[model samples]
Target: MGSLHPAEKPKAIDLSHHLNNLSRSRHPSPLKDILKYMVQPGMISLAGGLPHPSLFPFESLHTRAYAPDSNLAPGETKHGVVDIHIPQTSASTSNIAIALQYGPGTGCSPNLVSFLREFTARVMQPAYADYEILIHSGNTDGWNKIVNLLCEFGDYILVEAHTYPSAQALWAPMGCKGAPIAMDGDGLLVEDLRRVLANWETDHPGVRRPKLLYVVPVGQNPTGSTMTFERKQAVYALCVEYDIIICEDDPYYFLQLPAYAPPASRKQESQQDEQALLASLVPSFLNLDYQGRVIRLETFSKTLGPGNRLGYFVCNPIFAERLLRATEVTTQTPSGWSQAILAELLSAWGQSGYLTWLRNLRDSYAIRRDWMCDLLAERFDLENSPVPTEGVLAFAKGHGSRADRKQLFSFVQPKAGMFLWLKLNLIGNPEYERLRAAAGPNVEAQWNEAFWMQMIEAKVLLTPGSYYTPWEGRDPSPNRRKEEGVTYFRLTFAFESHEEMRLGIDRMARTFELSWNLVA
Candidate 1:
């Protein structure tokens, strides 16, 4: 796919006619509006029940040295170490005085808000003229607020075939239904999306037309499929045509990996080459949004740490204000301490230093990804092997040798993110095929349960694909039936150490060989 040039003009969208009823009803908080002017010079009036900063007892905070480089030698003491310190004073942005005291529900600290604004302008560069940002607890919290603000009960939410489990959990309890769109090696297919929308009324009689699309565009959860710039453009065009609001939940946007190459094919590159690769990532939906239809949910969970519980929403002013009102009633604001600490770090790092940090993170994850993929390849004995037996390849006109047909498993080498989605050869398993025939309507669920148990016994744990699958009642596409009984697993290469990753894969390989009766 070709890259989107910054100078190219994006097609404009009319957002005023696209807002949901709840969004249209929401208005800015009166208290929050007045709090902004309360912080003027030499103005010390008692306002919205804010506590005295002096009563707080915290004197100072200190953290251990942080080294960006992970390749330090065992005895390396003076190579690079920077200790972080925050004093409890009224002057500093990291001061405990403001952190402990009550603050705006929209954002805790002014300095942190300013830093994020600059970061978003430089990185995302949303094309909309009247965009706004609001800090919240995290992506999960942000998603909940979005769902409440945009969707009514029993509304339809369009989602990828396999998506984040937590999103499904949030939608189910609220009486919202998921209409699954088919996906491929490159994430959500634009063709499938068009078909679903075109035949919505016929396929789903009496159901409300879906107005919301929830997608993890970059390094999509579980699937590990990154949508190309062209694919995003096509999907955005559909959204405009259908007047759907896009909730872009992209936590792994910055964790994108470089183009895949065999281990031996990789050669050392210069710093300039590495920098160029980072700058050449696919543009986000927000960048393409000419109208205010896309609400981007960005989190510190993936980049900084989940413990911080901080994230922000970037949307058109209309939706942003409504989301802020929703936030006022729910989480109110993200942790003040987290906001202060992040502001301090970003102020010190600046724009260039922050980009450098992201590059370091990407490189580290890439190392882990390479290690896991290489190990899986060795375990599967896929060295110079043809494509394995699967849906698309099974009935191909020109088939390869019998040896290729004997291969029992395969996976798409993830271009980005921490997951490796392994597609199991359940069709080749005698027990699976036998049970599938006579297990009645609940066959798919039963088979998935049995397969999960076997993997657990083999001492290799993984998230079953069923968790990511959309609800059956809401999915009317014929493609959903074909995937109902399919066996797949999601493995994360983020938390495990190198030794642990290898050992887990080794156990999983043994189980695969025994189950499929494959020769070593």
Candidate 2:
């Protein structure tokens, strides 16, 4: 991959005004700042407390890494395995000695740091000339640093109506609230964002509009929506108009799969060259960002392993400096072991090999996604939605007559990420319909809980919708409140085997059939 940036590009717009007091007050750690001096040749320094690689207890670390093009399926390691050794001595550039030693928050190993920079520049291709990268201990740490850097107590921030719960939880203690914008299958609506920001005082009296926007554009957490290039352009334009900073937490960016094709319509998957693969995908917010207002939080968690706990930020230098200070006090960097291992593997594979691996992983997950959708089709009378949203499913099996058939649940077969966001149709279920009519308020919550408990009793586990649903009293839609009347579940095809997926889906289908009084 080559740079999408031109020879001359604009520098980032000064977004310093948006920073809170804490970020403005941040100063580089004096001891950490001295690190630039240690890297010089023949510099015999005893300035900061540092460990010698020879004295380190660990000698050699032997690791068998799956090759870049591994099948990534269960028991598919036979595809290829690359041997890696992290030597204790400083013989190699990214040896264990230096990795295991205390290092800067920016990164542990220069080799890994260099690798990421090239990866971001070549793959992510940020539009600006001066975009900088800062490594951290994955998206959680990355977001935490940003939260501390940008958020003052009692500030509001824009989030998807259905957003990541943990992120919202992280800022709540500081009195920051979520100003959730409406979303459809595509993602958070651009108009909704404009409406919120443009009419802040009128719509939300006693409080000002938010200055920060947190979004998971690719494979959004609960909704599994991926914003198209035009959609992102619109969203970015709105952010620019409103002077808002966009925080892109896209862990599943590489897990991007193709649109759903029924088996009959399926086409053979082809290997994509690096450039072709790059062209096929939607560019990141960073790529569209000329002003460097987008703070992209990317992670190896989705592609490699979550245990790696390695992620990085692509943002302007101003924000990077403040985030570095936050990291000094909290999670400094990813584990040295993680850095060394990743560096060795990445160095061996190189950029092209890694992209091949990502494509393979994407294809494998797509097959798993198809499998889950197939199971859903087998277990119920899954049909085209009446509304006819592409890639969406509606399932219902009436007792006998076709007229009795009603949509019990539906989901947009996600083009990215692992989870299927199943939207329940409570009005379609006869039992639920009768209850909704007879029972007064909160009936949906009670019934949904009871059904979820039944699924639990039947040995099926799923995350409840309420967990991802943003806190109430903020959304300005009456129809949006209708989401409350329905139940939802996030089913994953990432970890489980095909057999396990079958069993789980079987249990779920049976549970739905029995609970909804539908015929098999």
Candidate 3:
């Protein structure tokens, strides 16, 4: 065949319009609201789950960072290599160059695990000492990898009744199921977990147990519920008894109440007080892991900044190898720049200083926590009021039906993390169409999609409740059979300022009033 001439070459076909459909599957843009309301300005937005940049030690990092200690001979440099513990406001100019380079797939070039190791030792001790560690892009990445490693298509995983939405979303596409065990305000109900597991076993004898048990054992997302030490012990015992792996996804482990903050910098502070500081802090599941079964996921998204997209997991060497293999195939690793910056920050912070920083973060979040809770309590007539709140998020129940949720969706003002989880009352008939209309396009295709659509169309976005089900491929087990009982939505508060949070709440209240007025 003769070669075609330049003029004869077919004009390049454009598929921009056709490609628009793909955007539906993509993540909600952080800047979506900004784009939507570009012309009309608004107040501080609690709509995003974001960390305050003002709180970050930007000045400190700009001033005191050390030179590339990786290049220095161990004993040769007393002048350039800054010890990880001593806080620095800036680094040598060369340190900036080091951060700009591409990082290894595993994480920071110098490795933050050293500090993590020391911190793990001082706090976690003998149990976690022997466990292996692997760094990743973020907690979500780590969580996906853990599920990928442990679960085959259609396998089941366990979660709390109301839990983190992103994690639930991650499992949905893989044909995996989430069997939501009931939860109390404190977190996953241990007795419920025990009963559910026993029931599953009784029902399906020889088949595999759940691929993993996922829980945010500390300062849980949405609910901002922290697991008590007693609860932790009970849950841990169940995992041990069940021979199931526990994926401990605690991004809010450090954002506890102000009472947990370490001692202030003062000349006369005693050693005894330091010991007390360490003892009083809430313990993590990894801290109590007698076996390597507990996989601890750590993230810089909360304390550092969500934009950083940095997180790590500590567990058995075997699991680490599997996670790394999965990382190679899936995400290929987190952002190189993010990994480097995080490593540099952690390497400079060391164990004690890092703990001190975490305590400070907890104290900062506590103020926001109280402010948000007080606002909600004064305004919303929730079915069940909260106990004195501690963490960054809170859960509330409003009097409304699934239809009311569509109109009144946006009223929640969260105090912590990036969102709030709302459980609404479903009225009258239970049919998929009503949920489908409330949900959007996917209403008929995937049950969750409908719920998502309903909320999205209302100018508020939320993850659907169905994504948490443990129903598997073509054959969803009878125990995990899908039903139309969901009456909930998640809203984020971390992104907005106090003013924005209040505004979002006020707007939501109006939305509810309008919705209820129509229903009446």
Give me the candidate number with maximum TM-score: 2
| 1 or 2, greater by TM-score | 2
TM-score to native of every candidate shown: 0.89, 0.94, 0.64
Rank ordering of all candidates by lDDT, starting from the highest: 2, 1, 3
lDDT of 3 by residue, 163-234 (tens): 666887787787776777766557788888888888886866776568488888665666555688788889
lDDT of 2: 0.83
Q: Write candidate 1's Cα lDDT for 1-520 as tens digits.
A: 1134435535334565555677777676777766778888887777677777778878877764344443322223533555667778857557887777667777768888788887776777777656678998999999988887778878889999898888978878778778889887788999999998999998888988999999999888888888998999999999989989999999999888876566899765444343474467778898778777899999989888999999999887767767777776667777888887887777766776667667667767877887888777565555332532121221111122454444454567777888878666566566667777776776657777876788799888999887898864644455454754357789998888788989998887776666655534
Give stretches of model 1 more than 4 Å off.
1-34, 42-44, 64-79, 272-278, 383-405, 472-479
Model 1: lDDT of residue 201: 90
lDDT of 2 by residue, 135-179 (tens): 899999899889988899988889998899999889988878788
Q: What lDDT score goes with residue 364 in model 2?
A: 86
lDDT (C-alpha, whole model) for all candidates = 0.75, 0.83, 0.56
Task: Report the candidate with higher lDDT, 1 versus 3.
Answer: 1
